[model samples]
Target: MTIEQSPAPSDVADVYDGIGQIYGSAWGPNYHYGYWDDADDTSSIEVATDRLTDMMISGLDVRPGQRVLDVGCGIGHPALRLVRTGDVDVVGISVSHVQVAQANELAAAAGLAEKAKFQFTDAMDMPFPDGSFDAAWAFESMWHMPDRGQVLSEIARVLRPGGHLAIVDVIERGPVSPEGRKVLDHVCENYAVKSLGTVDEYRTALAANGFVDVEIRDISDNCNRTLAVMADAVETKYDELAALVGEEQATSLLAFMRLSAVTPEQGYLYLAAVRA
Candidate 1:
């Protein structure tokens, strides 16, 4: 029988809706994306999460007892981590129902249920009143969004005056040579992703959306190191992970990892920017 077509990016949100459990089984608790350390250290989930969090707070300067929002928070790791600082109320929103449920479960289990909360909601259409938060963060999830501007605008709408938004995301670097563009296009098609924007494009969008103090930090080296580490780790765990996800998915993941390792080398970097 012919295989049914994979869903579009809009549908992708729904696809990941229940994938939080399988999400970590393939990689780890950090969702297995981006660089973990800026000092060229070995990359890992724990390191990446810490690095991203630091970038968020330092860049946005999150204040104690402030209300924060995490767009596309996978499994609520960052949100829970922020809560631990005893200075923020983090509201994590994701299109993935699975992630939200697991995040909530984790938070409640850790007795952080009151300080951190997870919602199954779209980033472009968040459910909150105006000036709902003092700060916001999006870690490596911006590329998954189709309308980055709309998402940013929504984020701005929810943020109070002088509020900050920090985003740690993957952005394309340099002009894609026509041939290289073809290769990238092939990868995007295979993954059913609609698009990936460049660093300049994201900065432009943030600016056009009325975000000030936009900055682009080149952390490609960090991502490259992390990708290499993950490549090695996943190779060793392939068999066990395959047993968990079956042969086809395991193979897909391997291909994905290999491609990602090469992609950053080609011209991709973890970009952290802020709005004030």
Candidate 2:
């Protein structure tokens, strides 16, 4: 299966706009992968997803009264958490019009309309002034970027000098076997992902974009349980998702989840960097 060489904003928007709610229902507020502390940690999906957000918050290390750019923000729950955590203002952007409206409503309902705002914007070409933000984050969204470097350059451009950036994402750790390639292909095809980058590529991309003091953490083991948990969640909500997104997408989601759940090729990592 061939996904676009570079994931277009429209393609990404169509996919999320159609099935954003299904993800919320199955994966809770955040659309990114959850983090499990250990094999013994039996936290619920909500707790695990929140845990990942908290990790980003720590990595961001922004102070009160600062501004954060939430790149590819999905429905704004993570932005709400970040705003409430440090009393910082967050500007979240998403290509999906449906998600931006829903995200704004979520913020307003949470009494965070003043602190958190969501807009329909593409990360590849964000319309923001230079040095507009103190910190930024791209959560599970880079997978959809056709040119991750260009997106990183935009992020770096908008952020102030010394601004910190956090990215909670997945990567290709090493060469995958034929069996794993099938899983990766299905995931990229069905999920509207363009391609997976290796850890070294990530470093090179970040550094090239004027990011310094990079810290890339490999937390795949803790994050691997997400696909398994997601599989169960999707299975439980298959009928509802099928009704919303059609039978074909629902079936593909299940197959993607089933395959990714057992595949170890996808590595999860959260990286932090500071603008020089």
Candidate 3:
């Protein structure tokens, strides 16, 4: 019935620690949105999410033996895919200790412990040296950052000159009406996100942090179907989710998921920039 005004890193981590596996089972390894090509496209969510990952990897322009930072990496599945595709080394960081441990286990099971490793680290204050990585990837992670600019600056600092940063994030399209704002607020609160930023705002922050050749692509239409799929999954698993988290929280989460599925004001975007 009552929502926390602002959730801290620990709060977010706790939520993931409790429901990470269940969430992964319902949504699969890739937690981000899926890309749908057409109304009749019947590709599975896993395939579409992999397509999005491939798109991000292409935007990054990474090569073999390069070190890439996977910011806010969820369960390290995307990082594993990147290493497999490009033969690159990836260091994934997450706020949740459970995620880091689970990701490491998954990496070991896939025989990628040497190529892809995950650690419990905050994106706002990453534990990496300057120019340590050749490229960076942030997938659906920026919205949880309390200070988006600070996080961007940290990513820029860790990346080498000319290194690319590719991000696929949920964004606010523009000014939202009161009704829309209510839906957005509920979604943010339920998802442990501090706030949503506009595509322009993301571009400006990247530029301010010494990033150039910024690119922003609105992919709302392609990704909106993910929310609908997620909502249906939640509805089917309502009892299980309620048992994990309280009934009130589960009901509220289902409401937010359904609203997010149909809301036009909340959108998705793909952004890329090169370190200047």
Inter-residue clash pairs, candidate 3: none
**Overall lDDT per candidate, in order of appearance:** 0.68, 0.88, 0.87
What TM-score, to 2 decimals, does candidate 2 have? 0.95
State the lDDT of candidate 3 residue by residue for 79-121, as single tens digits.
Answer: 9999999999999999999889989999999999999999989
RMSD per candidate (Å) reads: 4.1, 1.6, 2.1
Off by over 4 Å in 3: 1-6
- Summarize candidate 2's per-residue lDDT along 1-276 as a digit string, tens digits: 346576778889878876756766877878888989999999999899999999999999999999999999999989999998989999999989989999999999999999999998888898899999999999999988888899999999999999999998777766788888888887787667888777898999998999999999999889889988887887788888989878997887777777776778878888999999
lDDT of 3: 0.87
Q: Over the stretch 1-276, how does candidate 1's per-residue lDDT look in tens digits?
A: 111443344465554542334445655666535555456455456766576566566766777789998888888877777777646899998777778898999999999898899987888788799888888888767767767888899998899878877776655555566655654565455443456667777778888877886767776666655555565667677666567668897777666656665664234444434455
By lDDT, the best candidate is 2
TM-score against native, each model:
0.83, 0.95, 0.95
